[model samples]
Target: MSQIVTLQAFLDHWAGSDPEKAAIASTVRTIAGTGVGIADLVARGPLEEGLARIHGSDPNGGGDTQKELDVIAEEAICAALREAPVAYLASEESEDLIALNPKGQLVVAVDPLDGSSNIDTNVSVGTIYSILPFTEADRDNPNAAVMKPGTNQLAAGFLAYGPATILVSSLGNGTQVFVYDRESSEFIMARDQVEIPVETREYGVNQSNMRHWDEAMSGWIKDCLAGKEGPRGKDFNMRWVGSMVADAFRIFTRGGVYVYSSDKRKGYENGRLRLIYEAFPIAMLTEQAGGGATDGKTRILDITPHHIHQRIPLVFGSKGEVEKIASYY
Candidate 1:
């Protein structure tokens, strides 16, 4: 009998295949512009250089080191998939949808660099990606290129580059976590079948933004508060780390809900989280782990991405609270 390596195996292999390959790719000459595919992006230079740059010690005299990290991540992604054969590429950094290998099987959406604000503090940051197959007609509508939701993703994953760069991915069946073995230049399986325990207690929300919340959100929080002190008769804890990836990673490891929603704040029409980059990937991960993700009204995956960096409200985690929050909406 032949061994059947899980889909996660392939992803892990890729993660370790090229240690220095550019993680992101672009062709826009300026710091901000439009480009295509993964090959044209520039390399991020050395790992130590990236580490130093990430620490705000870069001598480039350019923009913030986070931007440089973003570019590096973008380049790394491009280099990693230069031959992986993906079709359209939608990213948080680019305004235009990039056409790469038009006949390829996969359409990839990425947040090349997540949690850039945490770089200064040496906190954990990550890369989120979602993969969908190219539909027959999707090839024509540039905007409709990657139309599937996170629920329909063939592969969903994130690479956490912090104290140690780790890869977390799903291959439809289950989740896997791989740690970078720098010496061997390979990803070693540190965990498998990463199931998020479904306990119902704590919840995460940014109370500082409470003034901008909608009736539904505020109403739900009121209920949670009531449970904590008033009537519902349960003690509740609140957490808001400001970084979606960090907040979500904690939820995945622990058990809880995280919310960032549409509020009355100016410029918050669609919400703060990016649909293609942040919400979808996390939503997919949450769902795959027996958790739930919603936009208060609809499933996160059901909301098709209209733009590369389109923002949307997000609420996800333990089934109970997430459902309860959605019920309020």
Candidate 2:
């Protein structure tokens, strides 16, 4: 018989004296009847399944990019969570927050596939999520209640489907890292109370959109370019992996700033990051790790998701750099 582990049990074990604390934990229980690994099966596995349906061949039939793989992966991840005990589910793949367990206490926001454009290149891609408490006393209308910001999240985490599929997350106390035990098909605690050094001067930003950036953004990049010769006397290293989850993971582990700003492009008026799923989850995780997240000017957690798949500019990381970006805005 396959070993069974319940998410609820995991949560209870993780939750200490603060029993009222509502949070989410990554559990790798086998799917009933299928015996397929839950933790091991991220967007890639689902992407393979979806691609099989579309191509009638294996995922290796042709070289696939992250964007293409993401489309397939999003569908699979959403489908997997259909029966999860969540109140409302939001994702970068959907146009709105999906109602799952209406009476459930938590709302889940997910990015089924992030940095998918990097997949063809074998770059690190992953999934991000935020969990918020949905109390009945909040409101009767589902839309109004779920419009809360990322700041309201009770827990947040990410799954890095890389050379080693790992899950990193926190429920307010501190950050925790877990490894996907393929044999046991469960997430075993790998690291606890993980910390990110604040003094690191690394920064992440997409330079391709430099031409479309606003004056403030342009000015900020110029300053960073000046490095030790500029307003900030410290040297700065720039990193842009083209994947929000991957970039955010970098910031989460090592201190750095990441920006996805609103450009002059017509379609990119707001920004590229999805507010509910991608940005919200990363914002929560960042804050929990003693970092900051913002929309250049306003704090990311304070901004509610106006729309289900609302896209917004994101600037987060070391407090100093993030604040500098906000100052420009």
- The TM-score leader among the candidates is 2
For model 2, the superposed segments whose C-alpha errors exceed 4 Å read 1-10, 16-72, 137-140
- The C-alpha local distance difference test score for the whole of candidate 2 amounts to 0.67
The TM-score obtained by model 2 is 0.80
**Whole-model lDDT for model 1 versus the true structure?**
0.66
lDDT of 1 by residue, 1-329 (tens): 15444323454454465422112111111111211111122222233344324434322221324456676666666655545556677777665666777556567788876776655455666777877666677767756656555666766777665555566666565666666655664556666666776667788888888877888888877777886476556878898777676777778778799998988866586788878778887888888888889989899988876555667889999987888888887
Best by lDDT: 2
Please provide, for model 2 over 1-329, each residue's C-alpha lDDT reduced to its tens digit, 9 standing for 90 to 100. 15443334455676655534532442222111111232234435445454323222223222222354455555655555555555676656555567776556666666766765555465667777777776777546666555886667777777787766667777777776666666775556666666666656788887988999999999988887888889977788988888776777677777888988999887588886778777777777777777788998888889967676667898888887888888987
